[model samples]
Target: MFKTFVASALLISCASAISSFDSYKKSQKSNFTQEKSQFSDYKKAQQKAFSSYIKELEKYWKKPIMTSKKKLVSYAKDKKSRTIIDFGHNRLTIETLAKETQEAEQKLSLALVQAVTFNTEDFYNNDEFEQQLAKIEASHKIATPKIDAEPVLAPIFFKEQPTKKSLYHFVKHNITPEKIQIQKSSKIKTDKVYTLTISLPKDATIKRSFIYYEDVKREATRQQIPLALVFAIIHSESSFNPMARSYVPAYGLMQIVPRTAGIDAYYHLYKKKRLVGSSYLYNSKNNIKMGSAYLHVLYYKYLHHIKNPTSRLYCTIAAYNTGAGNVARAFVGTNDTYRAAQMINRLTPEEVYTRLLKDLRYSEAKRYLMKVRKRMKLYKKIYES
Candidate 1:
């Protein structure tokens, strides 16, 4: 009877253990199913959001076609608004407006290029030449001597007799012309006014429209970036104005924020010990160089694992406007700080781009990417042509 009781106890214990194991497995399966459902819902929401955004953007691009006269008048009153409206007025479509703007921009760019490229000899004339000579004289402290008296003859005594000598007396009286020294007045030092004439190949209005083409190209080449991409960035950033300053207090054509991207690029590429200040970015070349280098760093250092070149380029462009940290967050679908290398291993380039478009926190970054990509095509077309 005791033996029978032991067998029964062992069977009960084994039965309870199997039951617990089955319950654990069911709980695990239920949790996985719930997680899968949540992920599916999240993906659907993301798709919806992306779709709505694209539709809204399409509406904006198609805006001019349906723009009312009242709206045009309202836009026309503001100088800044009028320029955009005027470009679209004739085209009656966004494409035409873009083309019109591109053409106008190209004309202005060409005029500027010609102005900087043409030799200054064409502007040289007697008046300009004389002015330059005067400048040189003033700079060197050169002055002409003033002659106060005419040549005069004086009487000289030879032995015992006093005799009158003509002006030629220099030879007869042993008086040398060198002995009669002309008095030279001290140089009349005047404030030197430097006048520089910049002759534009076209009107001043057009020349002012495009000032920093060469600097953009030079820095773009030095950074090994596409010239069109640089131009697109400048077009989006500050429209190629070297003196541009943003509300963030970013400076120059590429709109560099010296404390952040500027310092990062300076240290990364230049390997400098000290950080360059904001004033340095006010220079057009410095701004472009730093901005482009920063973009390159984002592409290679942060987004390097993205296999698709175009996708990588787009992300890099967005990162330039936003920040790489935000980009990494978008990639991993997490707001929490995470490593890009770890996340990149799990995602394809297209997946990264889609995730960025759907998940990026900033609307401005989204708009920036679209505008830059659109403008890049325009720049390449206009530039090559």
Candidate 2:
């Protein structure tokens, strides 16, 4: 009976694999046929749509400015003699004005469709579709297995003085050593042990800190991220300076670029459009809120496959400094083009950390990761203590 059951399971698995492969082949054939059939018509449609849209936009812009005098004169005249100023300054009946507006709006809708469908071939050229297909194939190649819990990182020890040994340990473990403090031994005896402290910059102290503690804590809690991690990021980015601005023109404590990460987080979290000419990021509360929200997106959205909390935090921190694309590149090997999340799912936490440290392209990004990690430890020690 046992042999029969095992044999039946093996046959089922084989059938499923074969079915999946056939489905993939059918999808490929369909995509190819659709592309070939639509190629010429797609270009012609795009050109026609854009030309119509431009004509409508010109009409909209050239709409006549109806002066008060003209309105009064028109109103005084009989319906047959009276003429409303239509678009392009042409005198016409009110019905014509309404008709033109409706036509223009319709043309605008067609233009949008053209814009979206323009250069459909370019989409396939990027190989993203192929990569996604590959990922799906890989997923089906194996059955789902139980996931093991990640191992906890050991506590880091900071000595009284900065030594080569301590520095080496910090680098090996990917910790940032921001500040070192040496304390005199309190003991009167000739042989006494002294305490060495690893601290953040003086600007990070509460007295000089620009971030509102309550707001950061609240936002971090809302995002389900650690408060220490938020604090450390702000410390590394701007050293808690609310007015800080980076060379990239990233503003406020978290140094967010208003157009990129800021807008992305704003739309994702608030479910609203970010308007132009807004300077909300300069406000400490708003900056921390947006920055924290962006970090949340990076961790849970982009690096979601990294199961270990520590590994995810590290990759998210790196992504914050650099772009998420760069972080993904580090994971799949610099030379490889696999999607970051898909590749990350196949590796251990330690492997992810090691690859990030060694394979990241930019030296600055590598340093940024180290600094953020180091500051995180310091902030955790000070605030959580």
Candidate 3:
């Protein structure tokens, strides 16, 4: 009777564990599906406050679109350049131009401070309808039009942040009404606008953007990801744009996709799958933690079997931008990663690097790999310092 009771208790415990695990898996899948279904709303949230700023305002013509209003500001930063453009309602006189120049300096300072501080909560907000909509969805009322708060900020990338001037001088340019070409807008046009442009060189931009080093080093070391690589990827991905958002809808300093990279990294750190929100990703500390974890997943899990560390690093860089499947195909002409590892193993790291530069599936991926590697080398001193 004693042995039978013990056996019965063991079976009950096993059944309970199995039931709990099944419930966990089911919940994770449900969360993923629901998050994916709301992609449209979540994506729209990428644009900061929609409250009349974007809807009612007229914008200018540029490679990326911007709503040009009175004293509008925009920033473009990459590995080699930093650009800040501001629009004014009237064509500036010499005095006004000087004022605008000072303002331009202020705008650059603001951008850097935002990068340095990662204080971008104002940018990733949702409207009343979005909030209620989220609730309704949680309650499975998909068809109901729920009330959401009206959004009032600009898009995260398009949104301006805080700071003043850097040490380097800006190559300043001014554009009068005739020189400027804006996008045609249905909204009442504010006539006679002028523009101020400030262009900062690569080094100056790097110095300004490379803040939050202590946090980055801490997170990278904790995740066992290379500190230089973390810094390089951040510089290359956002050019240290704390509030940067790509059309891929990747968010924050590291440009992590909410579902894919973000979820994986969150799971790696906490053992729970979670979709990171844009505001959450905008925080530099949170962004680096997720970014470093994803890189660890890439190098240690997805690309682990490759024989050479140097060769593996190259593949990891390529995979980070493109993917493991593409990296595999680049080497062995197959998408089977383990099979490609055999081919990569036979080559020296130098050989793998050269071949990747030559044979990657997309020019953009190849360029991305190059940019990250170059920036990584550039960050080595920063890391050491």
Candidate 4:
């Protein structure tokens, strides 16, 4: 009886496979005939649809919606179709074509398994649902599965819209380092205030420092950090000193600590080289660039927790004076701005405010800010003159 049942199951499975194959072949013939009719109908329907849309557009040519209509017209023209198909409004035609084609191919492919099954009994007596279950396994057998051609992911080709990397390349290429150095130096000199008290060497490229300053300032602007804050930091750190130094041996116009910030970063910080000394710190452009970059770093670090610009600026300044780690520590167990303020007050100014004098550290950071403002006025008066 078991042997008889197995034979019956095999006969039933074979019958089902034959029925499915016949149905699929019939579907293929139907689809082929329908495809020809559909394309013909599509051409007729497309003409009618496009004409109707163009008529509607002609009626509302000057309306606000006309902009979108114009785009539709341009796209239709690009498609170069005789039919007035409103493909933009109803994409069903193309979608239907894709759907029908995929279904036909899938069905035809599924029906073709019997030829292979006869040779290899591996697929014999497989249930219809079971065969579907093994579709992934069956897919591996296909030597060269159909792969529809796709456009390569190349960069957009627009005569008007140049590539971003190309733009960067063109900019770097067209403008020689020599030209950049000269132009940057010139811009700096024009913007910088020259003081007779500090005699600059005839051999120095003072303008290069200014170039670095401008680049730093532009970067700060792009980041949306208040220009006032950057200028204030420079004022407080070195009095816009370009050549300012401190007793602790903090160097550069920005008064950057070499050991902490690393010797390698100094090149990027100043954008120029100098003999190792405190006087190099006094260069106005280098000071501003490093000072701004440091400020930007602090701004980013505390940006998530703090929302208020004024408060964030204070914490950033505190972080600048005291290490960010200490400032972060001070915020432990409290998100209260006032509490953070108290912690900042308790932290020793000496650890952070290496460049600030006694008078500047007095009124929580307000006095420091006041000094920066005062020095900024002095810088403006000297430069603007």
Q: Using TM-score as the measure, which candidate wins?
A: 3
Note the residue pairs that clash in candidate 2. 160-196, 176-374
For model 1 the TM-score comes to 0.44
Range of the 10 consecutive residues with the lowest summed lDDT in candidate 2: 147-156
Per-candidate clashes, comma-separated: 0, 2, 19, 15
| Model 3 residue 354 lDDT score | 94
- Cα shift from native, residue 239, model 2 (Å): 0.7
- Provide the lowest-lDDT 10-residue window in model 1: 148-157
Score candidate 4 by TM-score against the native.
Answer: 0.31
**How high is the lDDT of residue 43 in model 3?**
47
Model 4 per-residue lDDT at 48: 55
User: Is candidate 3 or 4 superior in TM-score?
Assistant: 3
Query: Distance (Å) between predicted and true CA of 75, model 1?
Result: 25
User: lDDT scores for all predictions?
Assistant: 0.49, 0.52, 0.59, 0.38
lDDT of 3 at 64: 28
lDDT tens digits by residue: candidate 3, 1-385: 9999999999999999999999989988897678666654654543443343334232322222332211112323221112232211212111111123345344444443333233333222222322332443344323222222211122222223322332121112223334332233322243222233333332543453445577788888887877889887876776665555665667667888876887789899999765656556656777888899999998999989997988998899898888899999998888899998988889999999999999999998899888888878877866566
Clashing pairs in 1: none
lDDT of 3: 0.59
Superior candidate under TM-score, 2 versus 4? 2
Tens-place lDDT per residue, model 2, 1-385, is: 9999999999999999999989987986685455434433433443454455435434432332221211101211111111122211212232111123334233323222222222212222222322232333233231112111111011112324335555455533422122212223312222121111222223324433322578788999999998888987886776554444443546666878755787678867877534211134545677788889999988887778667787788789888988788887786655232367677767787777778889888888889888888888887886778
RMSD to truth, every model: 29.1, 27.5, 9.2, 33.9
TM-score of 2: 0.46
Superposition TM-score, candidate 3 onto the true structure = 0.69
